[model samples]
Target: MAKIVLITGGSSGIGKAIGEYLQTRGYKVYGTSRNPKNYKSSFALLPLDVTSSESIQNCVTQLLDIEKTIDVLINNAGVGITGPIEETPISEIKNAFSTNLYGPIEMTNAVLPAMRKQGYGHIINVTSIAGYMGLPYRGVYSATKAALEITTEAYRMELKQFNVKMTNVAPGDFATNIAAGRYHAPIAQDSPYKEAYGNTLKTMDAHVDAGKDPTKMAEVIFKILQNPNPKVRYKVGAFIQKFSIVLKAILPSKMYEAMLMKHYEL
Candidate 1:
């Protein structure tokens, strides 16, 4: 029997690509979004607002009713909120955390019972390269991914006894539709950070525009699912970006900090 796979934020971007790739590979795939009807794809589409516990419960319930078990759960729903912290509104930060961090936590909790009963399951959390180090105007987004990384690390250890597996996928800039949904905090006319923020953002977008195709990440994820023993964390992107983690670890704090600031033109 084909394994049952569930993915959040599946309507588009890396999520959609993953769903489609898995579907072609014979996994019974289900993808979720608050408005799933917006996009058409080969994989199953379900309505899910990861930020809402009730919605997650309902969606998982519906999936369980039909499939009875979810062999893999991919927490892929996330948003990018970019702005100078000093100028960004509190509400924006709240919204980012609610969706990026809390949503995954709720979804993971919702599926644990079923996974535990089944005695074998795998979870893939789609984090990002930015999660490693704080970005200039994207600290809030960084914080959310960083938090998710920590959560996944802990869950990996906690779930070992249950035979459940958890993996954190830290991806670099991928050519996906993520930018379309990104929330750019409103900049005040009088805000001193506005000019620098504006200049740095263009540099950021340019790099993203040149990012690898969405299919590259989908392929990496596909291989991960097939592995009998997968690594706790997998990063998909350029060598320099993937090695950033090591660079930060070994380099002197001030030196590495300067490199990041130079990269972002901060």
Candidate 2:
């Protein structure tokens, strides 16, 4: 029997790319989108809204009815929000956290039972290097991912005895539709920081527009899936982007802040 893999937000971008890649490798891939009716993919399409408990449960239950067991899960559905820290509304930040952090946590809870019963499984949380530092206007997005990263650590420890594995893949900037809904700059029109925010976003968009191919991330994920013992985290992207994680850890706090401000032209 082919192994079954379920991915959230698999209708487009990295999630879609990874689903296609795994399908070609002989895994039975099931991908979820908010509206699966319109999604066209080589893998099976299912409906899911990760922020809702009932939706996550239904998606997993429906998949299990046909597949019997789920061998792998990729929590790839996420949203990014960008805006000046002070002006960004609490409601907006909460929404970002809902999809990026809470949704994954809920999805994991839904699938762990099946993975545990099967005696072996793997979970990959699609994360970002934004979690590593407080980026110019993506503070909320970064915090949500950071929270997921810390949770991944705790889950890894707790699941070790159950033959379940979890790891985070923190890609730098990948070209995707994530940019469209992410720019939360309502106050950019009138705030004193308007010019700075505009400049910072332009710089951020340039990197995103020139991001590495999504296939690169898919390739790395495929390798991780095939491994018997994957590591705690995987970073994928340009040399400097990946290296920044190390630099942040070694550099002093003030120095790191200065470096970030300089890069984003703050």
Candidate 3:
């Protein structure tokens, strides 16, 4: 029997790539989407709304009823939010955290009982490179992913004895449709951050436009699944993006801030 893998947000982007690749590699892959009927996928695409606890329970129950057990859970469903901190709506910030942080947490909780009963499981939280730092105009997005990353660190220890493993895979910009769904606070003419925020948004989009192929992320996931003892965190992206995390560890605070300011031309 092949491993049963459940991936959230698998209808497209990194999640889609991982699901398709894993299926080709002989795993039983199931991806989730809010509107499963709207997207065509090679593997099973089930209906899921990560924000709702009821939706999460239904999706997991539906999958478990068929598969008997879930061998892997990929928390990849996330939304993007970008804007100056002050201008970004509080409601939107909460929504981002709800989707990116609370949703993943709830999903993990939903599967833990089955996983513990089976005595084996792997949970991979798809975070972001942006989570490693507080980027201008993307602070909310950063915070949500960062919280997930830290949460996984704690989960790993608690799940160790149960044979349930959890890790965070933080990817940098990748060519995907994420930009289309991201919330952007309008650039008001009189706002203090309009000019800088507008320029930063363009830069962010251009980076995504020129980002590496999503297949790269898929390959990384495949390698991770093969590992009997995976690391706590893995990062996939350009050298600079990965290195940014390293630099933050070694570089002086002001110096690193200067580098980011220069890169964003803010």
Candidate 4:
């Protein structure tokens, strides 16, 4: 029997690449996006909006009603909110958390019972290197990914007995519209962080424009799904990301902060 795999935010970038790649490998792939009509792929398209509980519920319910079982679930729907901490409005911050953190949580909850009954399943959450290390102007986005990373850890432990594996894939920097589509909250002229926000946005745009191919990260994820025992976390993208992870572990707190400030031109 063909395995059924569902991916969220699969209309573009990494998610789309992964869905297409997996479809070629013979998995029965179902991908969700807010605007499914915008993309063409071999996988089936389902309408989904991670920020809305009703949308998430409707997607999952439709899948369960028709498919009966899901062999794998990929929680890849997320948004990037960029701006200095003080300049970012509370509403944008809330929206970021809604899509990045709570969205995955709700989706996982909806699928857990079915997976548990089926006796086998895999859950992959696409986090980011930002989750591992905080970057300038991306505080809220990073916080949301960090929350997902931590939650994945607990989920791995708890779901072990049920034979349901949970994995978190953290890619360094991939060619995606995330940076370009980043939401910038209103900042008052008197805000002290306005200059910092300008510098951070410039840096973000520069780095993202020169990011690695999204297919590279998608390939890593596909390989992980094929593994007999995938690790709790997998890092993809450039070697620099690995080096940064090491540096984060060995360097002093002040040194790490300095490196981030210098590299990001903040």
Candidate 5:
């Protein structure tokens, strides 16, 4: 029997790419959207809003009732937020955490029981390269992804004995509609950060515009599924983006900060 795979935020972007690729490879793929009816996908799209616990549980239950076993779950649903941390609204920051961090955590919780019962399962949290380091004007988004990445590390050890696998795949920017949905704290004319924040925001958008294809991320996920003992984390993106993580590790804290500041022209 084919493996049953569920991806949150499967309506579009990286999630959609993964679902399409896995379906071609013979896995049973079902993706979730806030409004499943709004998007048309080759595989199934169920209604899900990761921020809502009720919606998350209902989506999992519905899938379990039909599939009986969920072999893999890709927590690919997330929102992007960019602005100077000091100026970003508290409500927006909370919303970002709710979707990017808590949502995946809750989704994992909802699926674990069935996975434990079956003695098998893999949960892949879709984090970001930004999570590995704080970027100018994207601090909130980075923090949310960073939180998820750390949470996955803890989950891995806890799920080990249960025969459940948990890992994070952090991607650099990919060409997607994420920018369209992302929340931007308007640049205030009188704000001290107006000039620097405006420039950084434009740079960030340009990077996404020039980002690699989403299919690359799908390929990485497919490769991860094939591994019997997958690593705790996987990164997918351009060479420079992936290398940034290494640079951050080897460079002195101050030196790295300088490099980032220079890169962002801040």
Candidate 6:
């Protein structure tokens, strides 16, 4: 029987690339997306809104009815909100946590029983390098991913005895619609740091425009899935991410902060 994998946020970016690549590798891929109209993947597309419990439950139920078992679950749906923590509204912060953190938690809970019964399953959460190193103007996004990293570690330990593996993939600067969505945050009219915030947004856009291809990250994920014992965390992207990790290890906290400020022109 072909292995079954379900990927959330599968309509575009890294998620879509992973779905397509896995399909070619002889896995039966089922992808979830809010809008399924223009998706051209060979695998199935299930309607899913990660923020909606009803939608997630329905999507999972539909898949269970068809496939009976899911070999892997990829939690890849997430959004980005950019602005200083003070400038970011409470509503935006709530929405960020809802989609980025709660969505994955809810989806994981829904899939656990079935996975546990099977005695074999893999759960891959696509986090970001931001989870490890905080960046300016991305407080909420970073917090959500950081929460995910911790949750992934906890799950790795708890689920291992049950024959379920949990892995977190942290990719740096991937080419995706995440950058476009960053500009959609409502600007705070009373924000004292308006000019700085605008500059930060501009810098982010430029970096994303020159980021690595999503397909490269997808390839790393594919290899991880093939391995019987995947690492607890995999960092995917350019050498800069490794360098950043090393810098964080060697540099003092204040010096590291100063270096980031200088590099980002903050």
Q: Each model's TM-score, in the order given?
A: 0.97, 0.97, 0.99, 0.95, 0.99, 0.96
For model 4, the superposed segments whose C-alpha errors exceed 4 Å read 186-190
Deviating ranges (above 4 Å) for candidate 5? none
Give the alpha carbon lDDT tens digit for every residue of 8-52 in model 1.
Answer: 999888998998888889899999988877878788799999888
**Worst-scoring 10-residue span by lDDT in model 1:** 177-186
Model 3 local distance difference test score: 0.96
Q: Model 6, which residues run further than 4 Å from truth?
A: 187-190
Which of the predicted structures, 1 or 5, would earn the higher TM-score when compared with the native?
5
**Tens digits of per-residue lDDT for model 5 on 1-266?**
99999999999999999999999998999999999898989999999999999999999999999999999999999999988899899999999999999999999999999999999999999999999998888999999999999999999999999999988999998999999999999899999999999889888889999999999999999999999999999999999999999999999999999999998998
Minimum summed lDDT over a 10-residue window in model 2 is located at 181-190
Cα distance off (Å), candidate 4, residue 82? 0.6
lDDT scores in order: 0.91, 0.91, 0.96, 0.88, 0.95, 0.87
| Ten contiguous residues with the weakest lDDT in model 6 | 180-189
Winner of 2 and 4 under TM-score: 2
lDDT of 6 at 123: 93
Error of 4 at 137 (Å): 1.0
Better of 4 and 5 by TM-score: 5
Root mean square deviation (Cα) for candidate 4: 1.4
Residue 250 shift from truth in candidate 6, angstroms = 1.9
Report lDDT (Cα) of residue 264, candidate 2: 83
For candidate 3, what is the TM-score? 0.99
Top candidate, metric lDDT: 3
